[model samples]
Each structure stands twice: as structure tokens, then as C-alpha cells.
Target chain A: EADIYQTPRYLVIGTGKKITLECSQTMGHDKMYWYQQDPGMELHLIHYSYGVNSTEKGDLSSESTVSRIRTEHFPLTLESARPSHTSQYLCASSDFYEQYFGPGTRLTVT
Target chain B: AQSVAQPEDQVNVAEGNPLTVKCTYSVSGNPYLFWYVQYPNRGLQFLLKYITGDNLVKGSYGFEAEFNKSQTSFHLKKPSALVSDSALYFCAVRDGEVVNFNKFYFGSGTKLNVKP
Candidate 1:
């Protein structure tokens, strides 16, 4: 199993609340990515990091921001959550050719 | 830029029958292909990958994929289907030659339903 993990596997929050989805990996991979997915839909890349102190926005535009202060941790934060932001967020770490994923965080904004 | 295509939106197969989920890709250089399966309310799980050497690569959960260079296809296959195998499958591609190339493009996805 992949060592990557996402906290609060399920999250329910009110609109306008600030939230951070934590993603950590013990694999010590240099490349990490965050993807947003909806039910039965394709995953949309939201953010990624090549290494510590490096981050980039992905193809899909998202309001959330990310930080890569530590090699093992890549956390995504939303300044203000909204119902439109409700979706499943996936974290993955790459080991050369393949990317291993976490269980994912399902966010429900009310 | 790299891109992946999953032509079918859904595939239905009876239990004990064989199954195939089609995928095609485009890339500037040789492609690194991958197959990932997502269960309900869960993140994607790596099923298999094709880097080089073999045209056929086996992966977790009795899943396998055949890589066709001429057609640029890496289709996921299973000899027999099970109801528990029903899930969403995604195909992805990335350029292997590019150094520090981080983009991994994915297909829309194919939903597989194994009816019991």
C-alpha cells in the first residue's frame, strides 16, 4: 500500500469557513500532486510540487492554495470554502514512473 | 503536451466474463502509460503501468494491460470479471525523456460495471 495519507477522510463544513486538507507521505518522494475529483468524473489537477519550497498550479483552476515547506508534507488550504468547492481531493506521490495515491479527502460544503 | 483518451464512457460485463477498458495516448516522446482504478468515494489506486520492455504488464487485483506502440494504446484487461471489480478506471500518460517534466495527463475515465 502507498504510504501517502490525507487527514479527515471526510469533511463537512459551512460555506466561508477556512479549511486545510493535510497530505503527508512517508515515501520521501520529491514530486507530489493534488487532484480534485467529482463523482464519476475525471480527476482534475489542482496543484503540485517538485520539492520543498516549490509549488505550481495545475491545469484546473482552483481557489485553494498549497505549501511545500517540508518534503513529506504538502498541505492545501482554502481561504474560504464554498459549496462549489465540494468534491473529493486526492494526494499522490511519484516514484519515478508511477504515482501512488492516498485514500482521499471528501469535502462537503454546506 | 501529453494527452490520454478513453473512448468509452462505460463498459458493462457479466461476472466471470472477460473485460477490457480502452485507452489511447499522445505524447512528444516515448510515453509512460499507467492505469488507475478508483473505488466509490476513494482515491485512485495504481493498477498497472507500461514503461518499456514488455507489451503486457500485470498489476494489482488481477488486472493487466497490453501496450500497443503502433496504435498508441494501453488497454486494461482482466480475464474474468467480478462484481467487486466495478469501478472507474483512468488512463494516464507522461513523457519519459523530458527531465523534470511533471505533467501527467489523464483520460476522462471509463466506468466498468461487472454485473453479477
Candidate 2:
């Protein structure tokens, strides 16, 4: 079955530490997205990609950057983590309209 | 820009009772709307979508939504709520001519509580 996956379900890191969140999809979708969400709040789009070698920032400005080197993979990296960056990160993939989401990664920056 | 709005911050319903969560949207052209549910500490799961043709769309977990063009609303509903249905719900919209679907904009979710 086609699915999206995210690694490191939970992460606790100190401020200024650099970290990367991994996301992959076996669905072969060309468009991928990354979103930040707080409990019971609106999810903010932080990054998106049209396809391999193409990436763009989403509506919300993010301190993290993303790279789409392969069609199945997209990774987000924070140069220097901060306490404020602590939030749930979700990875999603879509072919046209509806999106499929991964389990998500909960990051806590101390 | 296309946008989605969920008016109620929270909705409470007794188990086996009907449930409704309101959603509204704004867009420039034709709109494609969707609903998703999130369980605690989990990712958003697609419940249903309204692309065209029908005013009412049925989805997973016995949930349904009505697309009211005049109202620009797509409210989620279930004939009988279940305790397991308690979760956060979000409504999203994509703006474009029917053929040109693109990025989506989401609403701030609504929390649903179904108690016995």
C-alpha cells in the first residue's frame, strides 16, 4: 500500500542544536509538503516541493529549510534549533487534490 | 488567497447524538473543499472531499459534509456520534478552475467531544 512516513517520532534537543527531520513517501507523488501544528490549532505550511530539485517556502516563514533531492524523499533541517521551534512537524504528499499525511514528528527544543 | 475557516473552537455532543462542525471558505474561483480528522498526537487523516457534482459528500467513519455554494460552507456531520469520534477536525480549500487544482489553504481546526 502507498504511504508516507516520518522518522524520529519524538525528538528532544537543546537550543542551537542542528537537526533534520526525515520524510518519505512510497506513493510516487510529485508534490510534497511540510507543516507545523500545535495542539488543536491551525496547521501552518512551512515548506513544499513541486518535485525533485524543486522546493519552495510555504505561507508561514520557517527557520527550517527543506531539500527535495529525490522524488520519494524530502527532509527539513534546522540550522540552529530554538525553544520556540518546538512543535509537531507533519509530512504530506499529494498528486492532485487530497493529501496523505505521515505520522508526524514531535520536536521539543529546550 | 484561498482560505478556510472553522467557526466553532469546540463542539460537544452526546454519544449516539448527531454532531455538526461548521466550516466556511473564501476563494477567487471554483473551490474544492475537504475535511480531515486528527486523533491525539496523530496526523491529519482525510475524511472526505467535495470536488464537484454533488452537494453532499460521504466519507470515512460514517461522517458526511454538505457543500453549500451560496453559503460557502462545508459543515461536517454524523448522524450518530461515537466516543471514538472525538478528535480535531479541519476544513481545507483549494481555489482554481476545476481543471487547475493547486495548493490548499486550511482552517484552524475544531475540536469535537463526544461523551457518553
Candidate 3:
């Protein structure tokens, strides 16, 4: 099985609260990605990291920021949460062709 | 730009019958195709991939996909469908050429429903 892990599988918070979603992988992959998925919708790439100290924005624009200080970890932080930000966040690490996904974190903002 | 399209929003099939999910892609260079399945509230699992060589590639869970260069399609198929096979299916393509080849673009996803 893939060793990718995401903390806080489910979260609920009030608007304006800052939150961080943690993602870690034991696969030691160079490529890590963060995607946002809504109910019955296609997953949109939000942020990705090529490797340690390398970060880039994805096809979709997001208000969150990501950091890759360590090769195994890529964490995303939102300065202020809003209802529009409520969605399922997925973390994945790729080894060339195939990508291994985490269980995902479902965030709900009220 | 590289992109993937899964025309069907949903595909329904009867158990014990053959089933297929359609996918088409557009890429600048040769295509690196893949299929992933996701259960409800769960992460996606790698089912199969077509990197090169054989046009017909078999993957986990008795699933397979045939890559057609002429049609630019890679459709997932199963000889006999099972009710447990019902889930969301995604088709992905690796973008960029040999030089800057990075990023995997996924299709909109197709929901598969197998009826007993």
C-alpha cells in the first residue's frame, strides 16, 4: 500500500480561522501535489512541489500556500478560511508515471 | 496544452456483463496514460497504466485498458462486471515532452454503477 498520510481526515471550523493541512509520504518521491475536489466534481490542482525548497502553483488558482522544507512533507496553510474554501483536499506523491494518493482531508467552513 | 476528457458523467452496466468507460486525451508528445479508481470517501487507487509497448495493458482488480493511438483514446474495460466494481473512475495523461515532461492531467471522472 502507499505510505502517504494526511492529518485531520475531517475538519470543521468557523470562518476567518487559520488552518493547516499536513501531508507526509514515506516514499521519498520528488513530486508532491495538492488538489481540491468538490462533490461530484473533477479534482483541481492547487499546489505542487518538485522537491525540497521547490514549490509552484498548479492549473487552478487557490488562496492557500504550500511549503516543502523536507522531502517527505508538503504542508498547505490557509491564512483565513471561508465557506468557499470548504472542499476535500488530497495529497499525492508521484514516481514518474503513477501517483499514490492519501486518504484526503475534508474541510468544512461555516 | 495537454488535457483529458471523459465524455460520460456516469456509466451503468449489469453484473456479469462486459463494461467500458471511455476516455480521450490531447498531448503535445507521446501519451502516458493511466487509470485510477476511487471508492466513496476514499483516495484514488492505481488501476493500470499504459506507458509504452503493448496497447492492451492489464491492471489490478481484473481491470484493463486498451490504448489506441489512432483514436487517441484509452478506454477502461472489464470482461465481467461485478457490483463491487462500482465507483468513480479517472483517466490521466502525462503532459509535456521529454525535456520538461511533468504534471498529470486528469479527466473529469466517470461514475461507474454496476447493477445486480
Candidate 4:
């Protein structure tokens, strides 16, 4: 099945710990996006990549940084995690008007 | 930049009754709109999309959406509501035309509740 996958479906980390969220898609889409959403809230675009080596920040300011060394892989890393970073992170890939989303990673920072 | 608006935070409907979720968009060029649905603790599933031509687009799970260019809206509608239809719905829009890439913007999302 062609789909997007996100690793570590749920994670709990202490503040200041370093962590990276992984996202990969089997579909050869050029556009990949990362969105942050609180429980029962709207999703905010935090980061996105058009293609390999072409990542850009989205509407929301994020402490996390993303790198797209390969087309299928887009990883978001936080040098130092914080309490405010606790939220659900969603990964998506788009071919045209439609976008496919992953199951999402829910993080809880203590 | 393209933008999407889903005015309601929540919509309640009864089983077997028709339901509608409103959405509006703003873009400089022709609009390519889409609808996605999310269940509790799961990924969002693509419900439908409107690219061009047809005013009404049918999609997964007996769901459909009507695109109105003059009104700048693409509202999701279902003939009969079900308890399973209770989920978060999001409307999205992308910039159209050759110069525009596949950049998508989504609405805040609306929660639909179907009471049995």
C-alpha cells in the first residue's frame, strides 16, 4: 500500500532532551509538510519541503529544524526539547490538490 | 498565498439526516480544493477534491463536495449522517496555475457529531 509513515507514534521526553521525528513516504511526491496540532485544536504548519535540499519554514515559528537530504525522508529535530513542544506532529505529502497524511506522532515533554 | 476557512468549530446532526460542512477559500488564481477527515488518534483520510470542470465531486465513504467558484466555497455534504461520520473535517486549498506549485493550506477544521 502506498502510504506515508511516521515513527514513534507516542513519545515522552524530558525537557532539554534531544529528539528527532522521522517521516517517510513511498509515493514520489515533491512536497512534504510537517504540522503541529494541539489536542482538539487546529493544525499549524510548522515546516515544509518542496524537494530534496529545499526546506522552508511554515506559518508557525518552530524550535525544530528539518532536513531533506533525500526525497522520501524528511526528519525534524529539536536540539533541545521543551515543554511547549508537547503536541501531535503530523507528516503529509502532496502530489496535487490532495495530500496524504501519516498516523502522526504524539509527544509529551515533561 | 492560498487560504481556507471552515467557519464552524462543530456541527451536530442526527442519524439518517443530511449534513453539511461549510468552507470558503481565497486565492489569486483558480482554486484546487480538497477535504480530509481525521478520526480519533488516527491519520487524516482524503475525503474528496475539486480540481476543475465538475461542480460536484464524489469521494470516499459516500461523501461529496460541491465547488462554487462564484461563491468561493467548497462545502462538504452527505446524504445520510452516521455515527461513524463523527470526526474532524478539514478543508484545504492550493494555488492553481503553472506558476503555482503544490503548496496547500488548510482550514482550522470542524468537528462533526452525528447523534444516533
Candidate 5:
């Protein structure tokens, strides 16, 4: 199994509340990525990091920001959560050609 | 540009029967293809990947994929289906060129239903 973990498998917060989704891996992978997905739907890349201190936005535009302070940790923060932001957030770390994914965080904004 | 396409939204198969999920891709450079399976409300599990060499690549859980460069297709296959195999499957492609190697384009996903 992949050594990646995502905190708070499920989350529900009120609108306008700030939230941070935590993702970490013990694999020491240099490439980390965050993707937003709806229930049983297509995945949209929101943010990714090539390595520590190297973050980049993905093809899809997102309001969330990410920081890669440590090679193992890549956290995403939404300044103000809206109902539209409610979706599953997945964290992944890649090595060579394959990517291993975390359990994922399902967020709900009410 | 890099992109992946899964023609079927869902594929239905009976237990003990063969199953196939189709995927096609487009990339500016050589293609690196992957197949991932996701259970309901869970993270995606890496099934298999095709980097180079042989056209057919075998992977975990008795799964395999054929990489067809001529058709730009990478289709997932299983000799016999099992009920436990029911889930959502995604096909992803990455460009092999140096500049865009890290980026992966994913298909919309195909739901696999294996009936008993």
C-alpha cells in the first residue's frame, strides 16, 4: 500500500470558513499533486508541486493555494470556503511513471 | 497538449466473463499510459502502467493493458471478471518529452459493473 495519508477523510464546514486540507507521504517523492473531484466524477487538477518550494497551478483554475515546505507534505488552503468548493480533494505523490494516491478528503460546504 | 478519452461511461460484464475498458490518448510526444481503479468513496488504486517496450503490460489483481501506438489507445483488460472488481476506472496519459513529463491528463473515468 502507498504510504500517503490525508487528514480528516470527511469534512463539513459553513460557508466563508477557511479550511486547510493536509496531505503527507513517507515515500519522499519529489512530485506531489492535489486534485479536486466530484463524487464518482472526473478529476480536475488544482495544484501540484515538483518539489519543496516549487508549487504550480494546474490546468483547472482553483481558488485554493498550496505550499510545499517539506518534501513529504503538500497542504492546500482555501481562504474562504464556498458551497461550490465542496468536493473530494485527493493528494498524490509520483515516482517515475506512476502516482500513488492518498485516501482523499471529502469536503462539504453548507 | 496531452489528453485521454474513455469512450464508454460504463461497462457491464458478468462474472467469469472477459471485460474490456477502452481508452485513447493524444500527446505531443511519446505516450506513457496508466490505469487506475477507484472504489466508491475511496482513493484511486494504481492498477498498471505502460512506459515502453512490449505492447501488453500486466499489472496487479490480474489486470492488463495493451498499448497500441498506431491507434493511440491503451485499453484495460481482464480475462475473467469478478464481482469484487466493480468500480470506477480511469485512464491517464503523460507526455514522455522532458518538458512536460510531470503532467498527466486523465480520462473522465469508466464505471465497471460486474454482475454475479
Candidate 6:
């Protein structure tokens, strides 16, 4: 049972609205990642953090920005949401090899 | 560049029969392979991993994966399939030799359907 949690398991917002997805883990892992996934599709890494104050962009280009001010918390914020931004956002923390994932946030931009 | 591939988009099996999900990977250095399962609308759950020790690694829910260096494959297997086992499966690989070794490449998911 991983202690990772993501808020707003499902979110529906109008286009152009600003929104933030919160991710937290109690395991004190140094490595955290944010991935975007379409329904039943391949995962696209969007953002990751090596540790507090260390954030890096992943392979896929994303409009979202992430911050790692605290080791256990890594939140992603979109300045202006769009219909193209509709997808599931997954947060995970890794301990060397294995990654533990949160429940994920499903976002819909109408 | 490091990458993971799951050739099959979906696999169907009968209950009580065996099941196999194919995975292949390409990496510059030693490959760290892993398998994860995801139920509908849920996040991925780690199934098993191939680090270094054994070619055959057993994981939760009676799942196992065999790592073949010659084939550059780490395929997930289960002796007996269950209806409850139906889900989306993902294969991931991390290159040990990369400067940013923390990054992992994930394969397109394979949907498993177990018919009773």
C-alpha cells in the first residue's frame, strides 16, 4: 500500500480556467514524476523532480508547471486550461527502481 | 535513446488458462525492466521488476516476468488466468548507463481480457 495521494480524483472545469493538481507522498522519496495519460493509452512523462527545489521537464512538452518546494509535495499547475488538456494526470514517487503511484486525477476541460 | 515496446495492443485468454504479455526494450546500457497493472480509471500498480539477480522474478497477484537478455525482452506471465486479472498492462525500462538514470520510458499499454 503506497502512501501517495492525489486530490480531485476527477475534475471538470471550463476552458481557460486555471487549475492545480496536488500530489503528496509520505514515503519521503527523493524522485517524483508527473505523467499524462489518455484513456487506456500510453503514459507521457510531463514533469519530474529529483528532490526539493529540483524540477525538470520530461520527454513530452507540457504547458503545466510543477513545483517541489517540499519533499513530500509536488503540485502541477496549468496557467490556462484548454480542451486539449483533458486527460488523466498521474503522480508517482520512486525508490531506486520501483515507482509507487497515486490514484491519479482525471481532468476534463469543457 | 531508451524505449519500451509492447507490441500487442490487447491479449485475450480464457479463465484458468495461462496468459502472457509481450514486452521488448532498447537501451544504451543495462536495462532495468518493470511491469505495472492498471484497472479501469485507476493508477498503475507495480507488478514486478527485473533488476539484476534472477531472470525470473515473481510479483504480486501471482504474476511473474522472465527477462531474456538475448531477446531484449521481459515478458509478463501468469500460469492461471482469472477474470479479475483483466486490465491494462504497461512495460517500462530505465537505462542504467544514462546520465539521467532516474528517467524511465514506458511502453504503450496492453489491455488484457480474460474470459470466463
What interface RMSD do all candidates show, one decimal each?
Answer: 0.7, 0.8, 0.9, 1.1, 0.5, 0.5
| TM-score quality measure for candidate 5 | 0.99
- RMSD to the true structure for each prediction, in A, is 1.1, 1.5, 0.8, 1.3, 0.7, 0.7
Against the unseen true structure, what C-alpha lDDT does each candidate score? 0.93, 0.91, 0.95, 0.91, 0.95, 0.96
Best by lDDT: 6
lDDT of 3 by residue, A42-82 (tens): 98999998899999999999999999999999999999999
Cα deviation at A33, candidate 6, in Å, is 0.4
Model 5: CAPRI class: high
What is the lDDT for A103 in model 1? 96
- Residue B31 lDDT (model 6): 90
Kindly list the per-residue Cα lDDT of model 6 for residues A19-103, writing each as its tens digit. Answer: 9999999999999999999999999999999999999999999999999999999999999999999999999999988899999
Consecutive 10-residue window with the lowest summed lDDT within model 3 chain B: B95-104
Considering only chain B, report the TM-score of each candidate against the true chain B. 0.95, 0.94, 0.97, 0.95, 0.97, 0.97
Question: Please, what are the lDDT tens digits per residue for candidate 6 over residues B1-116?
Answer: 78898999999999999999999999988899999999989999999899998899999999999999999999999999999999999999986785878998999999999999
Clashing pairs in 6: none
CA shift of A98, model 6, Å: 0.8
Q: Please write out the lDDT profile of model 2 over residues B1-115, one tens digit for every residue.
A: 6778898999999999999999999988988899999998889999999999989999998999999999999999999999999999999998675533657889999999999
* lDDT (tens digit, per residue) of candidate 3 on B47-87: 99999999999999899999999999999999999999999
Q: What TM-score against the true chain A does chain A of each candidate get?
A: 0.99, 0.97, 0.98, 0.97, 0.99, 0.99
**Model 1 spans > 4 angstroms off:** B97-100
lDDT of 5 by residue, A1-110 (tens): 99999998999999999999999999989999999999999999999999999999998899999999999999999999999998999999999879999999999999
Model 5 spans > 4 angstroms off: none
| lDDT against true structure, model 4 | 0.91
Tens-digit lDDT track of model 4 for B1-116: 67899999999999999999999999988888889899988778898889888899999899999999889999999999999999999998887756555677789999999999
Minimum summed lDDT over a 10-residue window in model 3 chain A is located at A39-48
